[model samples]
Target: MVAMPEPSAPLSLRHRLAQNLRRLRLERQWSQEDLAERSGLHHNQISMIERARSSVGIDIVEKLMAALGVRASDLLD
Candidate 1:
């Protein structure tokens, strides 16, 4: 049998951004629920964002950053 190449990681910007957001939030000692309330987004939405299962808009990103007292660049890191 022939071997297949390894699957690549997600290439979407949203997925990458989500990963950064999750890390920042955790570093700040905030739970998904806390981030959701502070960001004005739903808990599931934050969960989905962390899981890279959903897309996010710039506005939402800004809101989350503001609530977390983090810069947008931080979330993009």
Candidate 2:
């Protein structure tokens, strides 16, 4: 079977979301480990989200927002 080629550019929303997550994490000087503990998510998952390597679900996003003291709109914007 032929493998699908990866896109040259990341999806706009995911890229923006990743940027916001990283900025928020850094603003508070919270490492991935801190976010993992606060969000009840795995450190790898937080890293994946910040790196735009994985799509996030509503529940996970909510957890992250709560941990970051941000709103969904703030993260999206």
Candidate 3:
């Protein structure tokens, strides 16, 4: 299981999502542009998401999950 953040310093959901997204992408040796192409999102959008600068919707999340070959729980957990 993944470890949780400490009570004294909790990570926001957006931040966690960004970190997880970046991690998974890197694990696949995929660049932002690569992920963008696979996910049908703009590279800028992928950058914004990896930087936690955009509010992502369920549709976007689904696209990303599909492109990454991961389940929602994999991203969310």
Candidate number with greatest lDDT: 3
Summarize candidate 1's per-residue lDDT along 42-69 as a digit string, tens digits. Answer: 9999998787777778898889888889
What TM-score would each prediction reach against the true structure? 0.79, 0.82, 0.87
Best by TM-score: 3
- The residue pairs in collision within model 1 are none
Measured over all alpha carbons after superposition, the RMSD of each candidate to the real structure, in angstroms, is: 5.5, 4.6, 5.2
What value of lDDT does candidate 1 attain over all alpha carbons? Answer: 0.80
Point out the higher-scoring one by TM-score: 2 or 3.
3
lDDT-better candidate, 1 vs 3 = 3
Candidate 3 ranges with C-alpha deviation above 4 Å: 1-8
lDDT of 2: 0.83
Cα lDDT of model 3 by residue, 28-76, tens digit: 9999999999999999999988887888999999999999999987777
Clashes of each: 0, 0, 0
lDDT of each: 0.80, 0.83, 0.90
Off by over 4 Å in 1: 1-11
Between prediction 1 and prediction 2, which has the larger TM-score?
Answer: 2
What TM-score does model 2 achieve against the real structure? Answer: 0.82
